[model samples]
Target chain A: MSKKNEIIVIGDYTVTQLEKLSEEFQTIFVNKTDDLRSLSAASRKNIKGVAFKGHRPLEFDAASFDLLPELRIISNFGVGYDGIDIQEAIRRGIKITNTPDVLNDDVADVAIGMLIALSRNFLNGVNWIKSGEWGKSGEMALNRTVSGKKAGIVGLGRIGCAIAHRLSGFKMNIHYYSRSEKSSAKDWKFHNDPVSLAEEVDFLFIALVGGQETSQFVSKEV
Target chain B: MSKKNEIIVIGDYTVTQLEKLSEEFQTIFVNKTDDLRSLSAASRKNIKGVAFKGHRPLEFDAASFDLLPELRIISNFGVGYDGIDIQEAIRRGIKITNTPDVLNDDVADVAIGMLIALSRNFLNGVNWIKSGEWGKSGEMALNRTVSGKKAGIVGLGRIGCAIAHRLSGFKMNIHYYSRSEKSSAKDWKFHNDPVSLAEEVDFLFIALVGGQETSQFVSKEV
Candidate 1:
């Protein structure tokens, strides 16, 4: 197949993801922008769509986009597309897409796991058992309780809402601060600002998106 | 205050727990059976109730019960009263109580947290970010999804049921095995045997009570 007919896959993707992508499209695999530049002119020209994976900044500027004149869309593997120059893509009439809500459950699960692990002192308990202290010193001290505690979620977006939903099972009183009030989460207390949200809760979960708008979102004041 | 009028607190209790107990009653604190014997005759006779606080076997045999003739009840601090000789306590006309259902939420929270942590490779992710490998290695490899996977709960009692309830929020298919099927969890699949339950799920959580009856509950076969 001609190089121009292929898709470009950039970043550190898993073997399975890469295999799946390869099965579907004749792909030009590159780890970074430099690798993309290193590819032959024909291979770069043939790239019509870019499957951008990883968390690193892609810097999809005009010059980079111009390298692939046939590029129609830049499909980001993760929800955050801060690395991609959306303004540049828009100016050049290219469509930009991101995998957003697809990771909400996974992200929420991790957040809840971290909260529980921390509050319950799981590591301490494990170490106590492993070090034979459980046998010698007897039962470890009682750790803090997690359920019924107040939890504040910053940025009640897809992942935040999912986390709130799971935490509700723990009987936590949910409080949140977002750009605007989420009507769907009417039961949860809404704080107009991050400071108010933090002040009202025992546990605070930050789930804001990355990029200029959300950088330093959870500052000292918050 | 007479030692005979005090409550006997046996086990490795926290300073806070001991302080709390002391505030309520003149507590005769002892961690082992030998310590109980070390108590003055007057102190032993004054004990009316025993607040047993650790996993160490209390060995409330006939001889020990005879030592505290005024002993009326043995209130165990934890959910499992395995360390207490129930039959001996019954024969001696002494009451035994365990703090049941109080820790269901915490136990369930830990179980769910562990499941999510393992499936999502949370430790690996933390290490990646902590070691500065995230910047060097870019994105980590994709991890297994927690939601939509099958989970098996062994001994569907209080903690097991709580775990199942939380796993349901993750959209996990719940499977369980107990002495008898739990009618309340009709929606969850019941395995007549633990082996069958283990065969059907990706994650298996053992929430059985600690005792001789449940000693080898999760055997090699299961």
Candidate 2:
């Protein structure tokens, strides 16, 4: 039922990279402003994959996907597949893949940076210098320490391990809660549950795969 | 000169922890306020091994530390050591330690988060929701894919390595710049200068030691 393998890019992206990516797959850039009918009509003509379905929330449910039997896989652009209906995809025997681990450091870095910014008012201090507050007040004032504190990370995986390695330099007692414990890691302590991990740490980090498993994991405990 | 070995906490802290720490090191608490002179005078008299200097920047200049021979070490409470005169302390042979790796995960998270925030307008989107712009608007927009982007880090040390490791999850091409080169790390591409590193990546991170070699490392090129 296939003439040529078709792939769609559903978000805004650099044309340069898009051109390069097109060599591997047939590409279409469909953003918020896209026409679903055109997308559906295109899918009917032997299109096999939707590479960026989760870029925006789904406009079509499982019923719409059933109309086009050509759709075989939905390659998610990011780790969080909240926008996609997992049950619907699973029912249809459609394969779903997320670009995980790839963005771990970026996301983890952003998360930790945000923590520091919030705890010590780092952004406010930077704003002070930019907005001429430093000239007026002489300084932005002192900030909180980032060391000698309990650091807790949830979903200790690749990104979590990387974070723990970095946290080691800070002399923080690292605590983690995962579905399966890494008994191999003898250096850091582990809590039986998320509540215990949250309670033990002064700084709590959420670094787990997001799906049905880890949605609102931190919301309950931390 | 000697009574009981008194420990000093030279900043605002939770008294519960201090009481616990005092049992180990003769704890003393000195509140840092607007008066800098009194802050230094009070801290100078103490012979505490670990001084948790808070709010006010560490008050002693290098010469002033010379007057207090009993002081052993200054354990900084936070990440940025701007308040302490590190060079002067080095000259006097005083052991100055900082909480470095502790905040690495948190700070790296924030750095990447900020990049995403700035790039995607995550805060603006949140602001839109809080400002009641979400429902009123036809569609809500957030930032783009964090994965598969080029990331360049300055100073490939503990924090820098943490940032790189986290970003590695997103499948980004990670590059670094350090004074000396290493041959063992096959994954990380090393650049010789800051300008070269900045030129390569979509996101730029500054995680270097602040001293003679790195004060203005990520200069205007950013």
lDDT: worst 10-residue window of model 2 chain B: B32-41
lDDT of 1 by residue, B93-160 (tens): 89998878888988788788788778888778777889998788767987998987899988888888
Q: How much native contact recovery, as a fraction, does model 1 achieve?
A: 0.74
lDDT of 2 at A200: 79
After superposition, candidate 2 runs with Cα above 4 Å error: A1-47, A55-62, A81-93, A130-138, A208-222, B1-222
User: Native-vs-model 2 lDDT?
Assistant: 0.68
What is candidate 1's local distance difference test score? 0.83
Best by lDDT: 1
Interface RMSD of each: 1.3, 5.7
Question: What is the overall TM-score of model 2 with all chains considered together?
Answer: 0.54
Tens-digit lDDT track for model 2 on A1-222?
444456766665557767866877777666632443466564555767876644545544675576457778877766777667788888889888987667655565456546555776755765787899777776566666665578998878888886776566445688888887797667888877888888878988877765566667667546
Report the C-alpha lDDT of model 2 over B22-108, residue by residue, as the tens digit.
Answer: 766665566752223445655656553546555445465655465456677777777667666778778766677667666676676
Poorest 10 consecutive residues of model 1 chain A by lDDT?
A53-62
Candidates' C-alpha lDDT: 0.83, 0.68
Residue A91's lDDT within candidate 1 is 86
